[model samples]
Target chain A: MTGALAAAAGGGCHIFSGCGFPAPGLQDFIWTPFFTIGQFQFTKPMLLAILSALVVIGFFWAAFRKPKLIPGRTQSLGEMAILAVRDQILRPSLGRKGDSYLPFLVSLFFFIYIMNVMELIPVFQFPVTSRIGFVWPMVFTVYFLYLYLGFMHQGAWGYLRNMIPAGVPWPIYIILVPVELLRFFIFQPFTLGVRLFGNMFAGHLLLTIFTLATWYLLSLSVGLLYAVGSFALAIFVFVLETLVTLLQAFIFTTLTATYIASSVEPAH
Target chain B: MSVRDRSGRDTSVEAESRALGLNIGWTVFSYLLSGMAAYGLIGWLIGRAVRVEILFPVGMLVGLAISLGFVIWRFGKRGITREETSR
Candidate 1:
């Protein structure tokens, strides 16, 4: 029995023939560095980020460059969405003072939405936001704006006091002060980065897993069942990812307005 | 000039002007400084957690939440109606 099994194993019956699946390994899982210029090296994620930005810019440019008075279908839809962000999210949360911050907020909202939507594109089927390098710059931009606004409005002492708030009992100051400090210094930025990262990362991973599963099962005896299941899951996640892409973008922009509003409020 | 009018007008105008300046200044300053710090911290954390520096995008989200909470807490407390009215 052992000899027979050994002979059969050596008979060249590959377990995963014609599966069209990239083998699981570092080469398959790791993204390659595209090239290096001077000290800087560009990778897949970096390329994706650039592509995502260009796609977003191009799409909006085309959509709004030639505005129609009566409105074409695409332009009308685009205009309505931008108007919604301005009216519903920005104005209400930031108030009249929010007008100045509108451009920044709008850019952030659309850029993020496009980057997230990259997961659905055929050849560019990767969400650039899933990469941390791209996210840090964007996150930091907002973080810096917040800090600048806070200090600019209030002097050092005023800013510190502004943080502590008023009306808490004297005893509670001890508890609240540290908590507030932590929230400002640590929590805010962390949440912004993680929330977007987690969602995109999970979405991309799910899509990849289903796609690979579909391929793998298609090579087996009961492959049809796995393929169908994988296809269904992939489609479901694709739709979900689309919603998440937009929702995350909206959340990020809304929070930015809220932060700006908080810093700009008059100090008692 | 009447003492009441002179003192009330001068003090209210001064306070309002100061408040406006402070609001604009603090808003910009806090956003920039905290934004940079948060960005750096999130990048560091993501590199540490995921063993990948490119994972910084994931960290941005974490940083955003933390920083926003801080900014709100720090600034929100300053909105004391009593203090403003008293001034």
Candidate 2:
């Protein structure tokens, strides 16, 4: 997509010029590192990830630095962000008692939402979370916390015992126990990270394809209509990506809260 | 038929159910997948040992069936229990 766009901007490629359509693929995701120190390399996605974290931190710090009897606009915005996560994500899982985890959940939601939203931005058009390497750490954090909370609240043996759902027959336990344990330990966390990565990766690829198609099809003749159609599809995809960016973040945080709640209590 | 709190708001029940609904949705997927994976591996291994190539797919089917049974039992029990309480 980027190559096609650059070519189009340079007035280089058209249908009659014998240039084949450049289809976007996994190559679009692989970035040339900006710099490297020893084995460690920094890339655009890393920069965007750091910028997202800084943005979340700076916005909240600026908004709530001053104590207020009644909230001003910044403070009001900050409260709304907090309250949205709390009411929609946290309370649904942990109830009023989970207010203590509010800060962590709120930060997570914004951090992820911003990273996902980066794909829609002009220059930073890559979603940081599309890189699975960026996603696993967050997954491990949530998984670790879930296990930690389970062990803390329900002790080691009790937590292990809690993996077995209630009221199952004894003979069935032979089959069900292993399934439940594997589901809890492996599948849950695996799906959490992959779900985010898959959505962002697919969304980015779709946008790129339509965009590349738009540029590739643009001509003074019959292809102009096709270019317009491709452009329309790209716009439609962009709108959907915007919604998906937020939805993925919400689902991730909500599932994290759900895991924590199940750990602290017991599986139903 | 919403359950109310001491202050008469039913939001708590609503939120709890929403949470449970989300949990159940994921749990169902996990159950099916885990069952297939677990039994399928066992079936494949045994099949390999006994030189029965059919065991792998057979294992997956068994795993899937067990998972479905468990899901039906667990959620079905909950539905019955809820009906009893509501009555």
Candidate 3:
């Protein structure tokens, strides 16, 4: 709500205050910290990220606290959530052997979904995952876990052997080695975090633009039609945001599973 | 084993997972991008030292080619398929 667009449209049409369409930029996304302790500062997105994790953890705790063989309503719901993730996400990449990681995968899927949905949520309309600090932890966790799994399952030499593809010829190693190293070490995690960040950042910005435009365009006379149009676009963007929130979460979790799968065995 | 997508239609989990794996196309793209940036910079510096401006683009092209080949070798050669897994 503190966006440049909102700031520009503040109160009403301002002739002296220089009223025009203000483009949303990094300034709009920066949140002033609520408090600071020494060099550490606590910000809103950080709170939201923590809250997202707590909500996922709390929900699962409450849902599965009292397990029933016959399955109560809460138990059934919890079971369904887990089963959906396992079937759609884990099973796809890791297959049946991946059952051991069901808990981790379920937590990841829901946490990301919750954080993403926050952008649409009232009062807390910000996708915390839009920040690199929030996304990189997830990426690095996946990066380290998969790397550990890779080395563990394949050993040092075997892992390296499997990583650099066979039959590329010794002459091509000059080029391929750097490419492969950069791909794995740098871009793999970089893309993982950036893809999530980019989607959420863009989504939040567009939603702000449309919503702010709708507010700014509101008038009793000629501007009425433009206000309506902007409002309609805002609604359309909200619907699209719903799909993006879910899709981004699914993609992130699926990629994590695939990384685990690739690391644990010979990747073709 | 059938899995439902967002639409609730039944889909083979094997085929679905394979399809989903292709979502990693972004990883390939970023790999190519980083490859070009890092190696191209190195090539440019070398070119500057050697007085050949053309080496920069050549280095970028080589980096792109290497990343492309890596992608082809990594993702293109094989994937989890129902027919093959059934065997």
Task: Give TM-scores for every candidate, taking all chains together and pairing residue i with residue i.
Answer: 0.66, 0.91, 0.87
Off by over 4 Å in 1: A1-29, A63-78, B1-87
lDDT of 2: 0.82
Candidate 3 residue B77 Cα shift, in angstroms, is 7.8
Q: Rate residue A209 of model 3 by lDDT.
A: 81
* TM-score sort, best first: 2, 3, 1
Per-residue error for A268 in candidate 1, Å, reads 7.0
**Model 2 DockQ vs. reference:** 0.33
Calculate DockQ per candidate and list them: 0.04, 0.33, 0.26
What is the C-alpha lDDT profile of model 2 across A3-46, one tens digit per residue? Answer: 44444556656665688777777877887789999999898899
Q: Give the Å error, residue A77, model 3.
A: 1.2
TM-score of 2: 0.91
Candidate 3 structure quality by residue, lDDT tens digits, A91-174: 766767778888998999999999999999988999998887899989999999989989998887777766665566788776
Instruction: For model 3, state the Cα shift of residue B69 in Å.
Output: 4.8
Mark the 10 consecutive residues where model 1 chain B has the least summed lDDT. B1-10
Which has the better lDDT: candidate 1, or candidate 3?
3
